[model samples]
Target: MASIVPAEKIDVIRRIEQLAVGAGLAAIVQTAIKLGIPDSFDDGSVTVDELAKSAQAEPGTLGRLMRALTVHGVFDEVEPGRYTHNDLSRYLREDAPIPIKYLVLWMGAAWTWEAWPRLTDAIRTGKAVIPDIYGKDFYSYLGAEGAAGMGDFMKAMTAITALSAAPIVDGFDLTGVGSVADIAGGQGRLLVELMERFPHVSGTLFDLETVVANADPKLLPGGALADRTTIVHGDLYDKVPVDVDLYILKNILDAPNQQSDRALLNIKESAKPGAKVVIIDALMDASVEELRVTTLVDLFLLLNVGGARHNTKEFEILFEKAGLKFLGIKPVPGTFPTQHLAEALVP
Candidate 1:
């Protein structure tokens, strides 16, 4: 006879098993989106055969993929052979009120698949693995000609900006701020939203030349906000060549510490004595569920850029090191991954 394991222990074992094969779940969801399965059906339940026809997949194998997704609660299998969209699945639709399809695609992009496996090496060296694998930095690789999934990555950034821009702008008090600079703001989506919200605020959009070249048309010449918008192109690490009443660095400080420091110092060097500096990004200290999501992102940043999300203390230290006065941080409600506004002043 053999000794029996406790039920709790068995559950633990099952959880570990699930964790081990997590990649399969990611792959299946991405496959479903790529096959056009989510968009193929409307609100009504769909049969495997109908889905196969709409998605152009083999009925038998598509059924297997559906089973995998349904088991994860992504879709509901009401009948043995019929499936319908659940709340979770509906967000994968292209026209979702709050879109997430591009974000999902970006997470499962080809480069991530290559980079994740080298996490161990990244941890050991305390550096990014992208350079070793791709022979260049993460941005360089993404911007390289003929790069796979580059379009999806850019679209994903736009999707994220769309989701959080309203809340972020609302949380910020731009009173008395006549001029603003969005440093490293991709395509200036948030900047456009800000300028539209505060008609009196003239804004500057700064980023790499490649990125600002595609700035929102409204921010470009002859567009709605063109007269009030200035597009500057250069590396933030080299210099931030703008002086404004307020500077917004949104989700761009997730590079190595040296680079993040350099960015803050550059802002400090260029800003006026009382200029406001806002660093908006996800904080490390958060609820368990939020941490569960963000910790993975933290590690992903490490693998790609050797960056980590900073806690309040770490942020204070960062500001202090760069010779800026650390004010405090406040949560920006309704943001996914939960962003916080860490503010400072050029003194």
Candidate 2:
């Protein structure tokens, strides 16, 4: 007869089993979103048959999906055969006040499903696998895929910006800053938020031609903030042509070191003495749970961009290498992944 295992040991084994099959859970959630199940109903509880009719899915299969999701707390099953949205499930709605549906979709994009399996190769080579798999870098691959691929990514970035922009602007002190430039600012959402918060501060949006072509309507000519906003299209690796009191580099510095360094040096070449640069992104130093999340993102970056999230010292080194004086970093309150604003000044 086999010796009996302790109850705690059996629980540990169960947890290991859960971790082993974690991908199934991710797939289930993505499937629900793709089926439009979240948007099919409102606050009221609906039967499985009603949900299936709205989603155009088979009632039996859709009920099974709902049962799995409800068990995971994504939605609520009020009784045997009825379900309703919970706080977590509401964010999956297409018209959520703080929309994150695109973000969820982007995370499960087709490329990601292919790339994640190659994480081991990326770790072994210390380079991105996207190039090997797609025959180009991540951005080039996105460009090649055109709107079908790039649209979800841009919208996802916008969704994330929607969540963090207000808090970042509220916490940032713009005193005496006449102008600010958002470097590689996708769609100028953050820049719009910044300009709105500090009416006295004029803003510049610098990014690629393709990206800036779709800048927030408020930043386009004849729009409300257009008079105070300037849109410039150029590559950051080549140069940053805007000279402003403050340079905002948000979520764009996670590229490999050479590119990140070059971007910073380009900014230094353009900025005047005493100009300030703030790098806003997630920090490696975080609570255990936050690290658990970011570490996965860190590897995801590795698989796509050959980048890693920087700790405080690594950030200081990046600033120093670019000939800027490192100031310090402070947490941006209300940000998920706990973004930190790392500051440096031109010497």
- What are the Cα lDDT values of the candidates? 0.89, 0.91
TM-score of 1: 0.95
Please provide, for model 2 over 1-347, each residue's C-alpha lDDT reduced to its tens digit, 9 standing for 90 to 100. 65487766998888999999888888898999999989988878999999889889899999999999999999999998799899999989998976688877887899999999999899899999999999999988987888878778788888888889999998788887999999989889899999988999999999878778888999999899999999999989998889999999998898999999999999999999999999999988999999987988889889888999889889999999999999999998999878899999999
Error of 1 at 276 (Å): 1.0
Per-candidate TM-scores read 0.95, 0.96
Q: What lDDT would candidate 1 get against the real structure?
A: 0.89
What tens digits encode model 1's per-residue C-alpha lDDT throughout 105-160? 98998888999999999889999998999899888888883335456766788789
lDDT score of residue 31 within candidate 1: 94
- The lDDT of model 2 is 0.91
Tell how far residue 235 is off in model 1, in angstroms.
0.8
RMSD of each: 1.6, 1.4
